[model samples]
Target: MQTPSFYFSRICNALKLAALVCLFLGTSPTWLHAQKSLSNELRAASEQFLATLSSEQKALANLPFDSEWRYDWNYTPRQRKGLPLKQMNEVQRKAAMHLMKAALSNQGVAKAEAIIGLEYVLREVEKRPENDTYRDPENYAFAVFGTPDAQQPWGFSVEGHHLSLHFTVVDNKVEFLPSFFGSNPGIVLPGYVQEGKQVLKEEADIAFRLLGSFDEQQLKKIVLSEKAPNDMLTTNTRKVSLEKREGLSFGEMTSAQQKLFQELLTVYLNKYHVTLKNQELARLRQADMNKIYFAWMGDREPNRGAGRGHYFRVHGPTFLIEYDNTQNGANHVHSVVRDLTNDWGEDLLKAHYEAAHKK
Candidate 1:
């Protein structure tokens, strides 16, 4: 009856004692007023959507709103939201989707209406010819760093292809860690599965019931360096000192494997914001839950679906969560959550932009 990480660990202990005075006046006035009000409303909706482009639509609908277009995913977030809806026309793509629905959340406005339904699957399979539909969810690019209005610190990202989202709202108290949620043809079968079936499969059935409560040599010292480690040990690399917490340690499991590893890392620290998912499970209960590691990989056999032996991963110390249906057979899924020092807490947004814009 009460789970979703036990109401996200009781709303992360009342939002970590309501941000204990900017965590003892260290910074965050609501992330510098949601990063100066979302950098002045998406830089004035990217300067009125680049004053209605037409120098070849301002060299193919401009860019800089995002750095390296959120690590380019070979396009298709509706051709990156049609490069600002093809350089904005319908009143500047409804004023940049009303400044991204006033800074995201009708579930981030259904991820920009699923990138305009992936731009009608790239204008109906990019005019067929064995059409791959020339993928493009605008490579899922959208960024607003430091300024919106709720907690003075701000970030909203919807990165490419299979999509990733990161949300931060520090001072007002809401941060969804190193958050990345992915799906590639995760069930877009008959014309967008009519918005019903999203097959992450309870993110791989709660990590195969927490790695079937580990035992075979505690799942071989947390199944390290197998395959799934290429891109997210908080890939944004914040300095947990890249690898070598040397896997497996929830005090070396078994209290029913630490209650299925705290109900599968409280489904990724409660997908954030119950006071930073209770100050990251009170920092894994002050680093003593018998250390903490619950790793698993490539088809321990789940209807052998995550493809190529269907991989899985989960790491610990204030969290890292991952899932892969190994390409597409397990019905394509990629999951991510990291707080290995608040990534995109980009060093707490460069120490609140050097103690308030070091003028």
Candidate 2:
């Protein structure tokens, strides 16, 4: 009997083949367009997560930040240092923390661990004799918006440098968009940096692993440039543009190669609650998956120091995930998970709230 891993292996190989074929024929992976729909389990898992938020925590989902400002005080950031996860005596904090722990896949856990590593970096940086900077409270704070109770649509932001997760839950359902994760000093300076490693090696390696699978022709479209893009799209914007798909398409790939596309899709969407993940999966299926893109530029490798300039962006229908490691050996890293149609639970929560309004 073939184990699940065996099946996964089969699927993975099939996708690799299909993805390559599309490139050879000048076609993109078309299966990217097909949607088998999210399983009930996925939806249920997401809902279960939402059911856990406390009223206080929901109020802090996300305060509107200025589009022009990158590190505005309005939005939570690691440098500002706001809500301490340890200080939460309220139910909201417990619920949010719980939901986050429960909702994330193994990969998500890995990412979260990477984020925690950053917090430690700041701490270690403060302890250094040469450094004058000390960690501030705002460097790692959580803000609540709306009530956290199931009755009230609410959310919380677990934020720090290059690591912000804005998750909104309404009526026992989940909506996580504009979720972000980042790392600066992907590695510490080669010297005097033993305590703090770049902290973003995993993310870079995993992304490149999938990207490396591509053949020569696929590499051209996927590698937009040697430089990484500025920011992950959809994270800071309302409506986004998909005009970048001119040369990229999945329809050209063989059926098996298309599976690789699916794997890529899985890597990002799986970061949130199952319900929201399902929605994202659905959106990806409906959008021109064949038109999705994987763009790169700048340093193809990572290092201990923040690189001078480097960036990369993956943009496609209902899909936009960007990463920039231009700071240290392309060190400074920024990656965001966005929902083009709805960010901050704008679409679903507002509608759900309106429909249930007593008025």
Q: What is the TM-score of each candidate against the true structure?
A: 0.35, 0.64
Candidate 1, residues 62-172: lDDT per residue as tens digits? 433234443333212345522434334677566555655554444435543654454444354245333243453323344444334443565455455554555554444
Q: What is the total number of backbone clashes in candidate 2?
A: 74
Best by TM-score: 2
TM match of model 2 to true structure = 0.64
Candidate 2 — worst ten consecutive residues by lDDT sum?
A: 31-40
Off by over 4 Å in 2: 1-82, 85-96, 122-138, 188-202, 229-243, 254-257, 301-310, 353-359
Off by over 4 Å in 1: 1-134, 137-147, 150-155, 170-178, 181-216, 220-247, 250-291, 299-307, 315-320, 329-333, 338-359
TM-score of 1: 0.35
